[model samples]
Target: MLTLAHALLPRIHHLAVPLLSGCSNDLSSRRAATGPSNFSIFNRRPTAENRSRLQALLSEERYLALDSYQTFGSNKKNKEQEATKHTKDIKLQDGSGTNSCQEQNSCLENQLETYEWQLKILHAVLTASGEQEREQLLKDHSGDICTLIHSISDKVKTEVRTDLNELHEKHLKSISEQYQSEAEELRRIHREETAALNEVFASSEKTLKEEIEGLTSELKLFKELKRRVEESTLKRDLQRNIETHGSPGEFWEQEQESLLFVIEMKRQHLQEQRSKLLQMQSMQNEDFKVRMENYQSLIQQLSREQNELQEALEQQALQKQKLSQEKEELLFKLLQQRTDSCSSFQLPPVLHTHLSPS
Candidate 1:
């Protein structure tokens, strides 16, 4: 069943949600006109709107009773599930039972639903025989039969049981005078049941009286509330009419003033927000500007050092050229002395120049 409900949940929600949403307007309209919805105890195929309406109508006790009902339902479902398992176990062990009997057996736990539906098969069997045989038949079907009758008319069962118990108690006290020895034991058992039923009857009567009083109080309150609502509605209509046709110039002036006040409030709010945004943006821009300035200053300093290094390289190159020229001159003088002593080879001319550092 859980698996089945799980699979069906999306579909159920899909179907139910639209219906529930559509109902909400009606519920809200009803509440606005009156108060809460009528139902406070019973919930039948409840929609979301119905649930909301019920919440307003329900007292704390009624709400708690709903919780108790859910818990009780859960317990009953667990018992039915156990009974189903028991039936399945019986089926697994033997294959002798007819299909109809098996179906009836499987439906045994559901006997709690309706007396007629549950006891159909039992009545069919019982009516096919005589009274002596009927007693034997009734004994065989006692479980299913009792459950069906009790499930169908729970109040009737209680009342009948009470009557039987009283009869038994009377019989027990007057056993020698009234009942035979064979009936004595039954009388004792019957007496015990009567006492219990009388107590239940008394309690039920008290509960009903309390419920009636509470309902009466609630009805009185509802009538008072209705009167007040009608008065409020009338006042609202009168105010609307007054606003419709009176003193156009003065009305427009007041409306203008209200509009201006609203605008001023909004303007102040927006202005504050704008100023905060500008301050944050300007702070970021200032930080960016500082970093840009630092970068430009670093570039200028690097350029100055680059020019100085170039000037130093020029001075070093000039010094090297002067040294090379002096060595060439000394060599030329030696060559000229060799030529004056009777040499035939001619020497090439060389120019020497010097550059200072910039």
Candidate 2:
């Protein structure tokens, strides 16, 4: 058992060393290569590959560890039973004969205690407790715990990393899908808008084309009606002139003669009007002379009346001045008469002075 335990120790060390170092190197390299990867979203293959490798190594290491522990556990159980029986046998022996038995019992108890200690360490490592508990276990069994911890910690790290990777991949996938769906919706909206705009533009263009056609037809009809009316009026006038005259030559000669006769009549009428105008002009000149004499006589009479009126106004102003002076003298006499009448009463000097006018 001792030799087997020693052989297993080296083997466990060999197996644990490579795994711990490899996992450490990988973790450090990954951390260094992808610094502050809080927003990383692209790389997944490398992590998956590393996870697969870790899972394989961890599975193999875990199977070996559990297998070794199972054999150890079974052996420990058998040894415990045997030690219990042997302790009972030592207890049954005589008191003086118990020295060698007690020594052997002590040796067996120590061996069992060491085995139990080792079992406790294994249990603590497998259970993967809190930091304090782990630290305590490590302090109690540093060498054995070191070998066990490397494999167990790597397994735990691999599981946590795998879970995180899976979660990250799911999140990235969900975000990508959502983005794609939104982009597709936006594209659909754009297409609908484009189609609607195209329809509106087509309808507007069609309406404009129809309006242009209608206007063009109306313009053509207006031009045709105007031309027809002008032609009809021209034809009627020509027909009436043809009926009045014998032929085109006769019409032209008659028109020329009629125009000459009308011109001669107008000239005669104008001459008579000119003679009447000359007579009226002479009569107006005689009336204007008579009116000028009347106007001059009226102007002389108005001027004489204006001078007489001005003299009357000046005489009135002088009479008004004399009346105002006489009124003032009468007012003074009336005041003096009042003062003389008031003197009989022996009025106060102040009253007399107040009654006197300035």
Candidate 3:
């Protein structure tokens, strides 16, 4: 039993060495590759200083190896605990199954021990018996011993094979169940995370769309207000121009026509005054001609009376002188009146200059 236990220890150690090394290697690679960026969607990662510190720690071969060893040990401990719990549960669930296998294993061991003891005893008896007796006994029991040994070995082999098949099937079933459960959990977590991300995206998109619409509305309102303000300003400016400079085409035309009418009336009045002055001048000239003819005829009659009456010659002379003086005075007054009328009839050059363009 000691020898068997020792032999199995070596085999167990050999199997564990590669597994431990592989686990250590995998842990070191994972640690080296993992970064802060792997955890977040925003891509925020560890600072360069933190990365440098981690690299510095990893740079020491002993520390790196120690860390990996510690990690692997912790993982192994956790796995061992889980395995122990699972084994306990299985024992609780199916205690009779393990008990039966143990009984069968003990039974097979007892049978093997019995078979070995029998062979040992037979060897001792043969040694103790004479050569002839031993030969005779061997010839009688050799075939039977061979057949019995063969039968026992065949039974043990069949039992062990069946147990191994059952164990393998149980292990396969357990592993498949574990994988299925883990896959389901992973799928559930993925679905929840995807839904959360989609919800966030939808909310953000809605908010942005609303903000854009609001901004667009505000812009349109500003444009409309600006247009209205421009229109109002233009209207105000037009009103001011009308107040200062009068209305455009129609008002200007009316004002121009009125001015022309006033100018024409002024011109007609000036012409009428000139014609009346000319008629008054002609009448004054005719009255002066008649007065001169009457004076000439009176002078001739006074001369005939003087010739006919010498005694009143002196009085006649005086009367003729008085008549000549009165005629001169009347002629001077007519000339002065003609000059005043001519001066009064003359129009200003400014009026003629203003009317010429029209």
Highest-scoring model, lDDT: 2
Off by over 4 Å in 3: 1-139, 247-358
Q: Candidate 1: minimum summed lDDT over ten consecutive residues — where?
A: 349-358
Instruction: Sum up the clashes in candidate 3.
Output: 0
lDDT of each: 0.46, 0.53, 0.48
TM-score of each: 0.23, 0.33, 0.31
Q: Given candidate 1, what's the lDDT at residue 313?
A: 50
- Per residue, candidate 2 scores C-alpha lDDT tens digits across 1-358 of 3433443444444443443344334433454576524211111222344445544544554555556556765787787777886666776874443445446545655654454345455444333435456445545666654445444444544655676556656655665565556556655765685576567656755765686577568767865886687568656756787788745676566657866896697679768856865775576568557755765675566556556655655565566557656765775686566456434323333233222222
Preferred candidate (TM-score higher): 1 or 2: 2
Model 2: lDDT of residue 271: 81
Which residue pairs in candidate 3 have backbone atoms (N, alpha carbon, C) closer than 3 angstroms, thus clashing? none
* Model 2 lDDT on a 0 to 1 scale: 0.53
Per-candidate clash tally: 0, 0, 0
Write the number of the candidate with greater TM-score, choosing between 2 and 3.
2
Q: What order do you get sorting by lDDT, best first?
A: 2, 3, 1
lDDT for predicted candidate 1 compared with the true structure: 0.46
